[model samples]
Target: MTIHLAVDDSVAVLTLEHGRGNTLDTATCRELVLKLEEAADGAKAAVLTGSGDMFSAGVDLLSIDAGGAAYVREFLPALSDALLAVFGFPHPLVAAVNGHAIAGGMVLAAGCDHRVAAAGPGRVGVTELLVGVPFPLAATEILRCAYGTNPLAALMYSGATLTIDDALARGLVDEVAAPEEVLGRARELAARLGELPAEAFAHTKAQLRQPYHERIAENRASDDVHVDRMWRSAESLANVKSYVDRVLKR
Candidate 1:
């Protein structure tokens, strides 16, 4: 399974475990949505983390290169769906960013109600532009909701990863913890948040997120068509290949 779900008291801990980096491929994205639905049914709050030292390396670029345009047509929607599921979740969702959270991974963390990163070598940021792709509409809206337009624009434009200190300073992460304590800290936060009156908490969350949801609903169809086209274009595919060769070395 790409995601493993475990319940600790009223808190559901969802750990991403697809491949070494927990990259968000089509299958993983679909599974994330399903697991989150299940979490909503069974848990009061949730904590999302990744196995080992990588929260997620982001989208499965190698898979994209191999699958080509046909796969891009399929993957983009699934990726957006997964992001929306996390962003719109009724219960409080905490991100335990144990390691590198780049591109889509960073978006997932931003979708969470609160974020805590492991204090060490792991970096966090949005790198979609560096890979020569535009943000899917849902992703852009989610980042805008979390960081506001100006900071979101700066992060998207630069595609630069930041240290935990920088991430905390920039408000990307709410707290920092030792590598081994990241999960514990996240679970603690989740449990505390779970203690709130469920209906009230859920309602408040929905109210706060309603604006972004409306924006996503209004613009996603047309924006995604353009995003899909760009992702499938020959130029973007070439850029993906170059990124893999030079940065991923795979």
Candidate 2:
């Protein structure tokens, strides 16, 4: 499975494991949503981390190249569901950014309450425009919540990938831990959050996120329609194919 779940005491840890990049395809996205649901039900708080040098490279472009628009139609909604599940999770969620988190990967981290990065060369950013696609509605809401309008626009427009220190300076990540200690730090924080009164935590979190949640709900359907159209367009497919080829050649 792309998502591996483990619970110890009150903290559930979900690790993303799908090849080196942990690319989020339709199956992986569905598995992520299911794992988050399980984590919420059984654990008071959760920590999400990646298993290798890359947190996630975002959507599986290789899959897109092979499957074409039909895959995009299926993958987009699954991506939205996985992200919304994390954003609206009842318990506090901490992101242990083990490595590069690009595009949807950044969105996943932004969905969490806290984001901690491992100290090293790992980069983080929203790269949708780099891939010549628009952000899904849920991802846009998460970005708006994580960054101010100007910074958000700059990051998306530039497709800038910041190092851990730069990500911290820009508030993309809360703390930087030694590479080996990243998961530990996230778990420690999750344990602390898990200690709070469950009802109060849930209610307050709901209130704080209600606006973003509502905005996503309101725009999701329409946004998906437009995004799907873009994916199905010949220009988008050609760009995606070209991107995939470049990456493969590297």
lDDT to native, each model = 0.94, 0.90
Best by lDDT, which number?
A: 1
Give lDDT tens digits, candidate 1, residues 120-190: 99999999999999989999999999999998888889989999999999999999999999999999999
Cα RMSD to native, each candidate? 0.8, 0.9
Candidate 1, which segments miss by more than 4 Å at Cα? none
Question: Which residue pairs show backbone clashes in model 1?
Answer: none
Give every collision pair in model 2: none
Weakest 10 consecutive residues, lDDT, candidate 1?
A: 241-250
As a whole number from 0 to 100, the lDDT of residue 170 in candidate 1 is 90
Segments of candidate 2 deviating more than 4 angstroms: none
Give the deviation of candidate 1 from the true structure as CA RMSD. 0.8
